[model samples]
Target: MAALGLSGCSSSEDGGVLTVAGSTTVMPIAEMAAEQFEEETGTKVLVSGLGSSAGIEAVQNGTADIATSSRGLTEAEAATDLVTTVVALDGIAVIVNDDNPVSGLTMDQLRSIYAGETTNWSEVGGDDLQILVVNRDEASGTREAFKKIVMDGTPFDRSAAVLPGTGQVRDVVSRTAGAIGYISIGFVASDFTSSTVKSLAIDGVAATEENVENGTYPVSRDLYFFTKGDPSGKVEDYIELVLSDEMSQTIRDAGYLPLSDASYQARAKAAGAEEGGDAS
Candidate 1:
């Protein structure tokens, strides 16, 4: 991996292309950043939302310069020389059709519903309508995070319709009367006042950015950008720009928690000190 990156360095110096592929959850931010980076540096960045697993695989095969993921790597993936960088923090919001009377769900109830134990809305304080479950495909980092954080040891109901991306799951849920799905909170905007699907509270706590930052949100996870060994040249530069103070507002505007919040306090403080020194 390092050899591939070193080999590509010469090309990067000549305004070569940088390929980034990964989680659809991270694609929007990457696309926005790519636009700005291109404008400033004149390097062409090719970004694709091909699911987290695919992105990791692309990096492993030397096809992609970086991979964006919403979940941590598996044991097998961690064993490789790949490096992980936490780009931001996000919540996995449980969403239901706007017409669904059901609002919030307890963690246990949500587990049961996904496990096929609770099949109807009435079972969890809603109408008598049959519950329709929308799920993301195996390749999705969002699905993996939901499985680990929300499902825990419980297996997902095989009968649920599985889509390949976050947007697809949300779209299906929004159009289906009894459908419920989980997606990155970033995609939902500030709230669901105008959306066809509304977000639900988990264990009585709302899936808001504040709750996520305070550690009250149960389904929150760190967003990531992965690379083969360590990044170099344009790859390193791009990652640095994404993590820099210049991108903090962009991260916030995209609905994900910036590095200034939650677990990133120390780093944020350090960054501030460095900026202050430079100014002085």
Candidate 2:
């Protein structure tokens, strides 16, 4: 989908406006913050989920004021002077349909499955069913993170059906037996323990928030907000609200790791130390 445009009055009297575009994984957090921000101040925050690459491009082209991403910038994108902020922490959950008897897979087995070398569930200890691998589209930050953390240097199977959003991947896997896909841990629950799909453990480790916090989860990542240099005026104010203590509970309620969490604090420091540019 195309990025969302700024809507409503642009005048300061209307409380100003800001546009956010990026990862679907980060969209829920941004949307929640936007509502609270609008209620607290009169500013109109327009948010969209067009994938991480699109969001970064929107900021570079002056179409968006802020960009949210689920993965770190590439060497080329990092050279563009984009200032990064670690907004939250998350884990990528590998999911299958509830009917599937298989519970977990080793890291090597997972890599092999996605790489198309393990085409049958029986190869990994399940029923004698053909494995249907679902994947995210190229623009997805989740896909990039998966490639780095799970696939390592291996390419995805050409036979996999690549969809565009987290929801699509989740839905497809939920209905098709033997289908498997990965998505943010926050998106795992329809209502915490009541999801239609089942999250599988990796290397005998469950995909839980606690596992992510202790650094045991095999596929954890930091969620980000990128700004073109330092933000100022209303844009700055809105970001401050999102990062503030008042928003911590809102973030937690939405199933994300808020900045107040000790685990996120540690991850944030490391990410901050590695960044060296601002978006121009």
Candidate 3:
């Protein structure tokens, strides 16, 4: 993953080929946007999912034109020359195997479960099977967001099986009968009945796009595209395309929450109010 953006320069020399690398959570939208941008314009965009931190590092090291991050930047990171733009909002869904009967969990229950305090499904109103905890690796932005929002800074159980990406988490939870994991809601199948893993509501709030848009979901986070400096030329045009109405359907089709004009303005205002605050 570290080698992903090592060869690319922040500025494209041929007036094409934008290099983007970052969060797997943001990779789908970036790829979709890239394809659309490429077709509409002549610029070619290359994208990679190399974890959030690595993405930022790529930008800082001049290896990438843009860095995608699921979580916001920290104060130290924000203080750097890099600039961040909020592209969308996403909900982190807590998922379990479809065989698990449990439909919801309170915040406390979720914290306890991840902390290794509750080891049995029965303790959470499920079948009497031993719980299998699946976690994201340390480099993942999803893992960082989950730890901050769900665990409240508590460390995950050491015994939890840590995987590298959201896809792996979903795959593991789908196959392991008692497994529990978390992923961006965008990766979840819209046809829940056919999906092998089921997303659980947290504290009665469902993990749906509508819920995220309405601010009713508890585990939502902003997605970002970071630039080493203010963008120009094709890079600037690409960012405009991503934020424009042209990409609204693209965002939804990718299973992410698309911001309306009002929502976008509101988010921008809120972000402005918190400038220099710790993000990731």
Candidate 4:
């Protein structure tokens, strides 16, 4: 996907506009928040899902007011006068076709499967079929997080099909009988009844918001929004709205864990401190 271009300044001169671009995982939540913000504050918010790397670049190049990332920024990116606010928590759920009888997987099993060490479903107690692996492209934050949390520097199978975004991964896995892919837990339904893809529990611990928040879920990570510098005006307002209680239900509905008061306060304090230091 291409970067979303902003009209004028990050905030328009008229009613104001906020441009957000980045992670497909964060796109849905940002769109929902943008819609609410536009209705409530009359500010036009443009959001795009061009991948996390593109989003970071957009912010760095002053093309976007905010960059929404599913993974945390690296130290190099953080050093470039950027401020990241943790807007929500997400769990990376390993998903498979609903028709698959296998329910859960151990971390070691997961590692082996992705690493090309296990090629058949029967190797892990499933039907006798070749396991088709689907993976995100290198630019995807989801893929990066999955590697860090699950693969532990191990590479994906050479034969794994590399797709661009979470939607593609989910769609592909849902239809392919022996296929498996990982995505943000929010992409999976809270309940499996309505989903074509089913999220697997890692080591018997379900990927629930409560589990992610409690640090029991094995594959959870923080979702972030990055600004080129201290957020002000419409950018600040939009970030505040995302972290507010009003958006808690939206966060849940989007399949993410809303930040607690303590988390929210800590992010706010950290951003404030960074801004203060930058001014000095």
Question: Each model's TM-score, in the order given?
Answer: 0.88, 0.91, 0.91, 0.88
Q: By the lDDT metric, which is better: model 1 or model 2?
A: 2
Per-residue lDDT tens digits for candidate 2, residues 1-280, read 3334442234222437788889999999999999988898867788899999999988877778888998888899888878887787889999999999999999999999999999999998899999999999999999999999999899999999999999888889888998999999988887633349989999999999888877788988888898777777877787788888888888877667887777677765665667753221
In model 1, pairs of residues that clash are none
- The local lDDT score (0 to 100) that residue 112 gets in candidate 2 is 96
Q: After best superposition, candidate 2 residue 257: deviation in angstroms?
A: 0.8
* lDDT (Cα, tens digit) per residue for candidate 3, span 164-226: 998788888998999999999988774543457889999999989888877778998888899
In candidate 3, stretches whose alpha carbon ends up further than 4 angstroms from where it belongs are: 1-15, 190-195, 267-280
What ranking emerges by TM-score with the best candidate at the front? 2, 3, 4, 1
Candidate number of the best lDDT: 2
- Which runs of model 4 end up more than 4 angstroms from their true locations? 1-3, 8-15, 190-195, 261-280
How many clashing pairs in candidate 4?
A: 0
The better-scoring model by lDDT among 1 and 4 is 4
Q: Encode model 1's per-residue lDDT on 137-220: one tens digit a residue.
A: 999999999999889989999999999987777788888888889999887653543456789999999988888877788998
With candidate 1 superimposed using the best TM-score fit, by how many Å does residue 63's alpha carbon deviate from the native?
A: 0.5
RMSD of 2: 3.1
